[model samples]
Target: MNHINEALKHAEEEKKTRSMMSSGKLRSTLEEIKTEGNKAFSSQKLDEAIESFTKGIEVYKDNQEVVKLEKCTDLTKIAISLFTNRALCYSKQRRDANVIADTTYVIENLSRKNVKAYYR
Candidate 1:
């Protein structure tokens, strides 16, 4: 039973990896960086978290590294979530305007694609 469970878990993870890989993007790695950013933030390591978050955003913004999902609805959502998380980090520094700025960036990017508008 234990072996079967482990195999099942591995298979699920592999399927996710395959999906990400087949998408022809650095979204997976960027997401990993975002995760690291969150972990760093949790540990009160602001500088490390900001670096990781910036790296993730850079990867996401790279033209050649874009996900081929055409519509990219999901990716946009992920981007917004990351931006929101970054906003929270900025908020910790009592930079409310910075939070609003990051939120505005997320909103503008989504709207630029003519996707749905989400008020931050």
Candidate 2:
């Protein structure tokens, strides 16, 4: 009985460690996507930038459960940036509705105090 309990505890610890590792990996991946989007945006590639940002947002949304479980503010900030940057791209393209939708999402869901979102 004692040995069985010890084995169970070990398994639980292993599971937790794996979860943490995966969380870190996801964060890194998100950061990379954000960087790529920024680069594209800086180069005046609105379409490419929008594509990268959208992909990042989708990836973040897909792993929201893990993000919430980890309680990482960094992930939330990255997500907010993705939306805000994409909104900027939409604005450049004169996509008023798309800009409004993205900014509204940031204002309504991510950060109510996001000045760029409010201004856009």
Candidate 3:
């Protein structure tokens, strides 16, 4: 029973990934979210900025299952940006743990040479 349930879950995940890949809206959506987050950050709305960045990160992570199936360097780059920007917001809020988690993700998964991430 567990095996069958696991197979069904995998099939469902694959179906969602294929649908998201076919839509082709992920890039534009992520860009919009990033822009909104930047605007919020510029306005010194740390909480709002964090919300936007977190939303962007969640969107990217949701579709990440298809990343291996289809190479999209742009998406990865945007995801990295989202994490970095969110880390900045966390820093401003004095949320050291959140900042560390986001920056660590960037350093480990995206760019080991990201000096800012290392510094954060």
Candidate 4:
């Protein structure tokens, strides 16, 4: 019974640690994903770029990361950029509805004044 309690406590601690995300690490991960997406975009690999950007968006949406940030505005701005870039990819693919949806997401969630979102 004593050993089981200790194991349970250790598992809980591990779960807590895994759920704690630092803002710096979160930013770094987002940037790395964005860079990969950018590379794909530059190579004219629209689909791959969209996939990478979508992954970046998912990372940005992680609750742990959002809770860790002191000011979530930075993340929101980054999300706007990512969505706008994805909209560009959709445009290249002639996926007009997707482009509109992505841009609208940025406009609604990030900022109405975002130039890229407006342009999209």
Specify the highest-lDDT model's number.
2
Model 2 residue 45 distance off true place after TM-score fit, in angstroms: 0.8
Q: How much lDDT does candidate 3 score?
A: 0.87
Candidate 2 weakest ten by summed lDDT: 14-23
By lDDT, the better pick of 3 and 4 is: 3
Q: Per-prediction TM-score, please? A: 0.64, 0.80, 0.83, 0.79
Runs of candidate 3 with Cα error greater than 4 angstroms are 1-14, 18-23
lDDT of 1 by residue, 17-71 (tens): 5544333345567678789999999999877887788777666665322454465
Clashing residue pairs in candidate 4 (N, C-alpha, C atoms within 3 angstroms): none
RMSD of 3: 2.9
What value does the lDDT take at residue 52 in candidate 2? Answer: 96
Candidate 2: residue 60 lDDT (0-100): 84
lDDT of 4: 0.83
Alpha-carbon local distance difference test for all models: 0.67, 0.88, 0.87, 0.83
TM-score of 1: 0.64
The segments of candidate 1 whose C-alpha lies over 4 angstroms from its true place after superposition are 1-24, 64-69, 111-120
Looking at model 1, residue 34 earns an lDDT score of: 81
Model 4 lDDT per residue over 14-60, tens place: 88668756777777888888899999999999889999999988877
Q: Which sections of candidate 4 miss by over 4 Å?
A: 1-20, 64-69
State which candidate, 1 or 3, has the greater lDDT.
Answer: 3
lDDT of 4 at 4: 100
Model 2, CA-based lDDT: 0.88
